[model samples]
Target: MTDIIEAIERVNGVLVDLSLEAFENDWQRQWLVERGVEIISEASRHLPDDLKARNPEIPWQKVAGIGNVLRHNYENIAAAVLWKLAQADLSTLEKACRSELAAEQSRGRR
Candidate 1:
């Protein structure tokens, strides 16, 4: 959960400085964001089903599958898709991660 939150924060930090045009034009930023997504996706897979069920609003399966796409189909990923993910999905994912973490902590689960 902390990994997911940290990954989102890292991507958000990069996105603050980039427009879609700049994000597309810069390979480094694209890679950084993609890597962050991979981390988020991988960590999300380890979350218990009940915890994820608490937030059905989040697309948990899609979140887990994203890393597979990044790993296997990375060459075909569009810059706009990545940009949209950063702009849109990231904040929602961050909120879900934080909420789940807090819930776990309150339950006395480390």
Candidate 2:
């Protein structure tokens, strides 16, 4: 669980470092986006199957998709698409991560 939380934190840090407006259009921020996608993919790999299966609400596929785009279609990946994803999708992903972390903490308390 700590590993998962740490992964989420790492991703959040990258997003913060890149900053909102910069991430929207700056091609220089591409490396950070690539790294963030990798981090999220790695984190997804560690998630429990039960947790993933029961909670179909999470966007695990999207996280993995980022890795795919960064790895395979690096050249073809569109900045505008990435920007839209950052603006529209990241908040949902962040909330999901926080929710999972909170659930883990509550379980530990019990």
Q: What is the C-alpha lDDT of each candidate?
A: 0.91, 0.66
For model 1, what is the C-alpha lDDT against the true structure? 0.91
Least accurate stretch of 10 residues (summed lDDT) in model 1? 101-110
Expressed as tens digits, the lDDT of each residue in 2-56 for candidate 2 is 5445655554565665655676567667566566656677677778887677557
In model 2, the runs with Cα more than 4 Å from the true position are: 1-25
Which residue pairs collide, candidate 1? none
Deviation in Å, model 2, residue 72 alpha carbon: 1.7
lDDT of 1 by residue, 34-83 (tens): 99999999999999988888889899999999999999999999989999
User: Which candidate comes out best when scored by lDDT?
Assistant: 1
The number of the candidate with the highest TM-score is 1
After superposition, which runs of candidate 1 have C-alpha atoms over 4 Å from their true positions?
none
